[model samples]
Target: MTPPPPSTGQPGPATRRTVLRALAALPASALALGAAPGLLTTATAAAPARGYATRYTVVPFLDSSDAGVSVYQSDDATDFRLIKAAAYTPPANRVRDASVLKHTDGRYYLTYTTHTWQDTSTTIGFARSTDLVNWTFLYDYTVPIMNLSRAWAPEWFVDGDGSVNVLVSCSTTADEWTFTPYRLKAADSALTSWSAPVALSGIGANHIDTFVVRAGSTYHAFTKNETTKYIEYATAAALTGPYTFRGTGDWAGWGGTREGPALVQLDNGAWRIFFDGYGDGSYYYSDSYDTFATWSAPAKLPAVSGTVRHFTVLKETVTGGPTLPTGVTRSFRSANYTTRYWQEQSALVNLPVVGSASTTAEKQAATFTIVAGLADSGGCSFRNAAGNYLRHYDFRARFDAHDGTSTFAADATFVLRAGASSGSVRLESYNYPGRYLRHYDYQLRVDAADGTDLFRQDSSFAAVTAWA
Candidate 1:
């Protein structure tokens, strides 16, 4: 977007029942979110995520009006294509709210819930696909007694124990809407055959779909709550009965309503959850610690730039350890300079203010803050001047963090006029006690020093506050 305004630099959690609230609106969101060859099941993708390498591939979608599914792909996550000019006609009135799961067994699964022709009974069902193209329907029924017929947005997750779990938001025979998150254990691949659906805690009314996953030893479920969606984490050392509901949150912000919760674990051991917002158009984004972990603050997906289709970390088993990117401090450039430090990385783009005095009459300036870093242990001091410490001011934006979530950076524009001097600005990391948390201070804190902040305050301030 306009080259992001020349990189002036800088930037910036949730809970449970908060979870139930989130699940409440998921079904309504999924109808708009899925239904290709199969369902568009989202995983509890990992946290500390790295951008995807494989470009966006064409995935199919069912158009209710066309009575069939359509296919499209956008190498770039935002744009879509009309590769196959056709739609998939389902057995029912409209096969809405579909979620596809690309499982660990290398097999893909699709699940969805919709009503019949007369628009009376709605049922949750499953299908299977190997190449993500053709799907084989596994199950479809009327509603309760195998009766309520008001179910919507169905999600399926296979846990570490090979237990197939299904969660959905449903309404009662009285038309009372509620989150009917369920778990079903499959004795065999014949998905049609399953144990009785065991419903978990009912969260408010209106919740209709849910996506879940497992990390460590617990299960993490996210759903569309009211007004603002939320993330809920539950633990079932065993797949049945006593599912302990211990986590809840709306970390993704309460102002802009969000829905369609999806979770995944990151390569770095953290977990991230995503959802779509209603009324408001930003995507909900945030993360947690472990399977039964609480969420941090959630960030909004940018509207100016089309939202990312979906993000998944491609993990590969490697020998030894990670080879981090090389860091460079001394950087000179054609008006744009970026470097990596211990906590964050930032760029410096020269914004020329023509006229006034002359080229030699100008001087450079900079400022900023960090989200999660070393905490209490922060300091800033740059080279006073190349020749001597001028009558210039000593300025800096102090920051010390320990949590990696909501990391931030901010900088200002430097004004260098004639008779100005050349000197470098720097900030020092005083040894921060306590591990604080994993990866707390491991990222690069871009523009943490005054040299970077000297660019623009409001832009950096806005970016820093963008997530939290």
Candidate 2:
């Protein structure tokens, strides 16, 4: 491992809470974009074209009682729910401000702070995982900064040149609560070695939790302003550069006391930024349709607000992964609303009444081949008579041709859980763990189980004799 260059400085003493909170509210120093965890490939490719299927894996810091990171998955970025509560907890370290990257070798790498806000340290921890749930300790790396009070909030940044880097906020003086952004470049693709730390220029001191993304030739950085307590914006021509702050002190319209600004591009070419509202203990996100110039009002992340802190989100595009079996046909009859049956018309899946007077086409539309799940064979995929698959797009169930992508496979596959009612089975979404295939207003859609009898009955279906 390459030793980071040494620097001269002197230390002072201060409480960890003040230093960490001040650093959290610090301003932008520098930024860069890195691959989000859960991606199976190594290529740092650009975002997929609009309409392509994608999955977003979110890692956030849970409250103090949970002392580790939690993992969440979402189809639409807005509705993120817990996938694992204890995704990665460092052995003797706190997983504060954890950043994830799926390396080229197809393993998930996590870089996080080694201590809580009460202790000062110059080292950050690293871990690796094959599956996002299980992680193995890699090593603890000490930043080579002399008299460093704290090295906090390490975030992975992949430059446009394909070089991997980590942006860390370092405070030299202990009592003053001053922090400046510094970065260490990965010396190799394995990320086991790193170059010396260098301070980011133009983005002066007192900024923390800086997250960056690239759009064309421009680099956009969203960082917190420690002094003003608002997330600010800056841009640079190069990755490690003279970043000029374009917006500061409420320029983005989000109120103060926000930190940990993380950005990810949506499948529709739009941009979304997630930030920590430490003051109110809520997590909020805002969308930008026209780059970073204008943003919608911040909205609390449903079910995620007040639950997590200082997190990062990784979006991975999947193709040709996850498969299903094609075999016997079956029909689904609604358990609660026995008169209605799962039917397809004009490519949409819905619950409609089917009786002896129903036509042959109606009967055929209601019947489907119960194939082994496209994503997980343990589950099942429904195939229509015309060779189309019953899949959920934008959370709505429909009959669409197989796209041979992992997203399609996951959307199409439904795990057969024991029915909410006796002798009935509820179709749970393979990708979204707690969500099930249910009918809302007679339209088939995947919704989270709300623990109500109506929801249980709506999601439960009985396998009747094939109508076709």
Candidate 3:
């Protein structure tokens, strides 16, 4: 089946037939990667500490404009939703290809391209944030490059020695794409001062969006080969060095016309690389279990694909945050699909459009009493109209009479999280910490979080007036 047009970051117009058709046509490889089809869910029996976040915050630019900088967050890298839109638009400058880093001073800092590709720029923009949401403009630190035509895609890299640096793509020729990576070191802890620009060796001109991460004694670099548009991999012993580039063309199977490669390490120690498939106007992320030696085929970033342009993600652990409320009879409204609500059908949960035309029975099916968790007090359980509870059976969400078993209690209970989107909430399975209560093809299920934009929005719900 032909896939539907990409979502416009709003409630989609997918009907049941289109959804089922799309599901039926999903590739086996996609199914294997949890991209949707039959159940590919995993229920690992372990939970993280309550009220702390091992969070992944994505800072992506919608475009090279004043309203471009936006912030998104996810529990499992696969599911991301917006935390703040236009979180910070730099004063009098366009924000593009932005990178974020939590500095040692307990503040978040941003580095980005100050102008569009059509304009000549010599400075990279900067900003500081106490929380990831609000921002204060710092300064547009000029790149110390002679006859610089543009300084683009400034990525933040903290060295092994605890020094901060920005890897920027520099070009001296106007209207030409020929560019090379340069290292700009922060001269002071305030990040207001920087050292002279030093050209990186071996990675010659025409390479851009260079993101570097040091593992052990080697620095692994992922840069876009401008000519081929394939994200190439390179390694060096030093920060600025004679690097070796491999997997030149189609080496990793992430097709060409990709750029702005950013990487973040998962809690499980695996790596995920995100890039823009500009040729098709999509954002794709690929995972590597054994580092960059191998990679899973790139998958679209659900709600974010076709929306955000070049971006980067920052992973951090948040502690002592807010907790979920109990004893509230509330109805859950889908974040992305505003008119939809969580409703029960034949003892199974689904996200269906709940509106005034529906009968009283239809409203009750969409209502649930949020109560203290049967398994863990820190979490919550959804109890429905007939006194049955919502639980995951074989990874599928179903409403059933409580069996009074420990496993049933655990399966029914979920840890509440501040939603990826503002004023929303995410339900993390109590037994499978990283897994969440989300809808796949409109059917409710407990699935492992894979770090997709779709997963992020599907798992996020807003507590609203009870439908009953």
lDDT tens per residue, model 3, 1-468? 111111224533322122223545654222110000000001121233456656778777774334558899876666677899989987786777778888999999988877765567788889999999999999998888888777877888887678888888777754334677888888999999999988789877767677777777887778776556578888888988789996788888888867777777654345668877766767888767565887766778756777776677777667843355577788889888889889999999999899988899999899899888888766678898789999998788999999989878987988776676888888877655456888888888887666656777888899999988
Candidate 3: regions farther than 4 A off: 1-48, 64-68, 320-468
TM-score result, candidate 2: 0.66
lDDT of 3 at 154: 83
Best by lDDT: 3
Q: 166 in model 3: Cα distance from truth in Å?
A: 0.7
Question: lDDT per model, in order?
Answer: 0.35, 0.71, 0.72
| C-alpha-based local distance difference test score of model 3 | 0.72
Give a tens-digit lDDT track for model 1, residues 116-207: 32345456666666655566666674434345546655566556656565555555555434445555545566555666666655333444
Name the runs in model 1 displaced over 4 angstroms: 1-91, 103-106, 116-118, 133-146, 201-208, 224-256, 289-297, 302-468
TM-score of each: 0.49, 0.66, 0.65
